[model samples]
Structures are given as structure tokens and as C-alpha cells.
Target: MVPEFFTQTNGRGDGEQTLAPDSSFSNLEEAEKALQELAQVFPQPHSFISGIGLDFATNEVSKAAVPPEAPLLNMEAKYRALVEQIPAVVFMAYLDQGIGEAYVSPQIETALGFSQSEWLEDPVRWYQQIHPDDKMRWSVEAAEMFLSGKPLRSSYRVMARDGRVLWFQCEAKMIRRADGSPWFIHGVGFDVTERKALEEAILEISAREQRRIAQDLHDGLGQHLTGIAFMSKVLEEKLSDKSLPEAEEAAKIVKMVNQAIENTRQLARGLHPVAAEPLGLFSALKKWASEVEGLFHIGCSFQCENPFPIHDVNLATHLYRIAQEAVNNAIRHGKSRNIVIGLSGKNGAGLLAIQDDGDGILKKQASQPGVGLSIMNYRADMVGGSLKVQANEGRGITVSCMFPIRSPE
Candidate 1:
């Protein structure tokens, strides 16, 4: 078999789409020669050979894009040095028990206060360092990568050796041998603690401002508008009793004032969905579903067959925003006609899911999610939950967020 290499990057979480082969080589020497030439094509050494492979049947080159495991360390000193100095923590792992880390860059110490030797010494260090709340989701997502041979993009918090919590945005791809068996995992993790802090600050500030505005709309403007409507209705009645022509204008003013009050109330609800009590989330969602059906001409329903108490207001708010964003995406992007919002909790675990019947997602678009989806993910992450977006069987998209059920002490 001719040793050939394909130039394909598993990206956008849509690895099922096939990539057309770029170029091929007739022999090992030819493939090696092409590797040297690839430096000019891709300036980054790691990216130049991230998913490369060759078949040995006829000694001809098969695919020729990125570098795989064996050739990585075999490269020139300059190339290896370039990889070690990158801003992120680069790593390679064997597909053995514990998914042992085979190689890690020096950046690990800088990011997590652990030297490379210490990290590599123990096979279970990686698993042990994960934050307790994040371990379950990490294992689930990692399993998806192993099973599908697709790239994994996940962000979660991990504990440093110093006992400080840091956020990491980890992305990894599984490389397979020519015989289709798993070889090793090549990945990178970037420390995002500062960025996460900034995001939290911004979201908190925005949430506080929203709560203020919602309160003004609900208590201040709503009361004022109610007074106006009452006065207008009284004037209309008095003018009608006096058989005056101005009664028609008074009735119109009363109708407009009432409509304004309803609009303001809806806006306030949108801004601050969760209330003082935990069960407020359930009532808010039900009301919003009715609003969506009326305003968007769609069929929207909220389901809470078994809702347990969630005493944390922040948790309730986060869940509400997740559902709101998912439904908006369904209506705006997916062009959905029917939407269902489901909330369930049992045995100290909770789930929020939104399913919609719409145009669903195109394979290409599925990889490139918009801003709304990205924020929804972060919103879920804020409350120690995981968000998943998947296309429905025939037509539509489903957004699900799962978390543990807990109340603040």
C-alpha cells in the first residue's frame, strides 16, 4: 500500500463529515520529503502533523497533512522547541488504563504548579486533579472522543497542586493506526482562569443591572401605568354617563395604557425570570412559554413532571437563562415551530432540556455555533453543569443541561 497522508483537521465537533485527500506520496522517502516541504505550508510544527498517517501495504504515502505521535519527537530540535514554548499545555496520551499521559510540555508547571516529571510519574494524576464537580462530565466527554475518534472540546475547572482552582479549556483529538485501532491522543489545554474571572464579573454586573431594570419595570412603571389605565377608564365612564363625544378618546386611552402595562410586565419577566423563591423558575418558564406561543405564533410548552426544590437563586436564574437562550435559538436560528422545555430532578440530580422541531442544524453550521450558544454553554458552566447540543432524528435541535441538585447552605 502506498503511504499516503490526508490534510484534514477534525474540528467544529462535526467529525463525521469526510474530508477530501489533499496529496499523496509513492514511498516513504517521498513522504519524508513532503514533510519537510510542509513546514513552509504550515508555520506551526504541531499543526503541520496533528492527524497524519501512512499505510505500509506498498510503501506509498497515504495522507500528508499534520504530524502524528512518532514523528513529533523525531523532528528537529527547533520544531520541538517551538512546541514546548507555546502558550498552551501540549500533551500526548496513551490509550491505556487511566489513559496515561505519555508526554506533556513544561507549561503545565506554569499553569497548574506541577512539573512535567511529577505529572508524568503518576498515571492517575490527571484524573485526580479534576475538580470533583467536573469529573463526571469530563469522563463522559472524554469517552465520546475515544469512541468516535473525533476531537473533544471541553472546558472545566481543575485543582492545582497548590490547591488553587483554575479553569482550563481542553481540546484533544484521538489518532488511530492504519488498521483503525486507537493510537494515542494529541491535545492542548489552555489556562483560562483569568478569562473566566472576567466573564463572571461581567455576567454578574449585567445580571445585577438587569434585576434593577426588571424591578423598575415591575414595581415602578407597572404601577404608574396601572394608575393611568384606572384614571382613563374612570374618565371614559364619566364621559359616557354625561353623553359626551370625548368618551371614545378616553376608552382608547384606557386600552392603550392597559396594553403598555402588559408589555412592560413581559419585558420585566424576560430580564429577570427567577424570583425570590426557587419554584419561581417553573412559573416563569410556563408564563414565557405562553408568551412565545402568542407572540411568535409557535407551539411552546414547559414540562415539570417532577420538580424538586432548588433553594439557590443563582442556580435557578442560570437554568432559566439556559432554557431561554435555547428556545430563542430554536426560534431564531432553527426556525422552529414547536418547542418543548422540560425540567426534571431526582436523586439529587437535575436536568433542563429544550427540544424543538425546526430546520435543525446543517452539518457545517453545527460546528460553528453562534454567540447565543456559546453563552448558553458558559451559563451552564457557571453553575457547575454541562450543556449538550445535538440534532434531533429527523428535524430539529435539542439543548440539554445537566447538573447536581443542591441548595446553598
Candidate 2:
């Protein structure tokens, strides 16, 4: 020991140590004597050794000054908890360059038939499960939106882990870093297959009702009117007598009956005409052109290749009514000298074009209400079709409609 002393309030010598001439305590007796004297002087919490020197110091150890942090909950546990509570599938991933590792909720098993682990390590495994025919196009669109730094909302088809196809609506947002770089994205999706199916079912039911009504008008009411006409003719023949004044009255009644029959027949044709079939769409179009031209004395022309089949009764009825409305509008409002009707079909689609060389629709636009246009649009919508009304190049109005050939059923 070199020196030992206690610095207390009084500053008195509370301890003392002996320094050997050789600076070493090799003998057990000398070490024991020095240790016994050091013990009486050294303070509590302080230590002394026989062989150690005063210059020999222990290295300082430092502990971190940071406060303790709370333990983090496992991501899988947190994810499962969230998914069980929400109706949608919640997903998290790093998607800046492309989709990185991610976690899909366990709900994925029920919604998409994919296990949670299958989608975690490979985020794009979701895309691989998408319907093959739609994947390429859907991916292109999604990637385009992502690169443009826009959020994505889309509906796509996915093949479930159970080998079933399902539809989903995905809504996602990107997370940007402090420097405006994309870091990741979070998304939620829900199954929309049931909703879509319900909508389709409602449409089919509506179409079925429309067809039934059309048939009733064609078969039931039409036959009764025909019977009335025949009976009226028989009564006229049995009452043939120049001497009888009631014979002239009976003749008048028969004439009236014939007119009523003709009118009823026209009404039946308007309702659902059998002629619509034999002539096909173009034939019906020609018949319509002739009747309207004869009625209004406005020259009408019909042309176009039979680009579509006229087998669908509902479609034929829709096209016929659309044409009927167009012609009536042209005669009453269009005030055009010539009207042209064109019908064509190709590639599983049908087209109906009507153009009139009239005063155009400028006058109607300013003064008359556009109820006709609205009605046309509504009728087109009823059949899952589109209607376009525009001014002709020269001086007329053109109304065009394109309808899908397949029935909703």
C-alpha cells in the first residue's frame, strides 16, 4: 500500500499505511500486519488489497441513461385481434418499389381461401392467385396508378385457396416518408360477390316480367280482338237488306268495328309484333321507315348489313321501340324532310342509328323540355344499352343506340 487516509469533516488522520522499501508485500506475516491496520482505518464501502498498487485503477463502466421501453405486442397477435373485429381483410406491407413482405389477416382464409402464412412472406402471392385472364390487365392498371403516386381502388377476381373464384373490392393508400418517398402501403378489402349476385338476380327477374307481358299482349289480347272483328263481319253479312233502314246502321257498325280491329292490330304489333321475327331487325327497320315516311310524307331510307342476330325477343322489342320513338320525334319536332334509319350488328353487339334531315335539335334545346331525350336514355339503360343524341354534320339530328345481343338472363 502506498498511502491510506480518511478525509472526514475534521480532516484528522483516521488511518495510516506502511510502504515497504521494495514496494512489495511478499511475506505472509507482513501482508497480514498491513491488512489488519488497513481494516481499522478504511471506511465502509471501500476495499484494500495487500498486493495492489495505488496507481492501478479499475476501468470505468458506463450504463445507458435511456428510459426503459414498453414491450411490443407481436404483430400476428395484433393482426388476428384486429381482423376478428373488422368485417374486412386488413393488410400491411412495404410497397414502395414493389410489394415487399406483408401480413394478411387470418380472415383471408374465409374470404379468399388463402392461409395467413402463405401471404405473409410473399405479398405478391395475392396477385398470382388472381384470375389468370384478368391479372395482366389489372396489374398494369394498378402499377400505373402506384407509380403515379395515387391511391388505388379497384375490383378484381381472385382464385381462392379452395379453388373457388371470388370478387373483391380493394381500397388502399400509400405512406410517404419525410422526404416524400413512398415507404409502404396499407389496404383493406371486402367480398362483393354476394352483392353482385343479388344485383344480377334482380335484373333477370325484371327481364322475365317484361317478356311475359309482351307475350300476353301478343297472344291473349290480340286473339280476342280478331274474334270481335270476325263477328262484326258476320253480323254485317246477315243484315244485308236495302229495304231495311237498320241495314245501313248495321253497315256503319261493321265499318266502325273493322276500324277498331285495325287499330287493335296496330296496338298489338306495337306491343310485341310477330313480324319482328320473320323480317329480323333490318326488316323491322325497313317496315318502320316505310310506315313513318308514309305517315309524315318525309322520305325515309333504311340501310345496313345484318351485323347481329334478331333472335332475342326482348332486344328486338327494345330496338323497335327505340326506333319508333325516334321516328315519332322526327315527324313531330325534328321537322326534317328526310329520315334515315340504319341497323347493324357485329362482334356480339347490335347498333341502331337514326338521322333526320330536319331543323336539328337547337330549337328543342332552347324552348322545349328534353323529356324525349331523357326517356330515350332511360329506355336504353333498362336494357343495359347506351343512347347517343347529337346534331348531324349538316343540318339534322342523329339518335344512335348500341345494345348488347345477349339477354340479361
* Best-fitting candidate, scored by lDDT: 1
Following a full C-alpha superposition, what root-mean-square deviation does model 1 have from the true structure? 13.4
Q: 33-132, model 1: which lDDT tens digit per residue?
A: 6665554455563453444543333434555543465565557566768989899999998775453448899999988899999999887899999877
Task: Give TM per candidate.
Answer: 0.73, 0.49
lDDT score, candidate 1: 0.81
TM-score of 1: 0.73
Q: Model 2 residue 64 lDDT?
A: 28
Q: Write one digit per residue (lDDT tens) for candidate 2, span 285-354.
A: 7787888778777798898865545666555766777887887888787787888889876555566889
lDDT of each: 0.81, 0.66
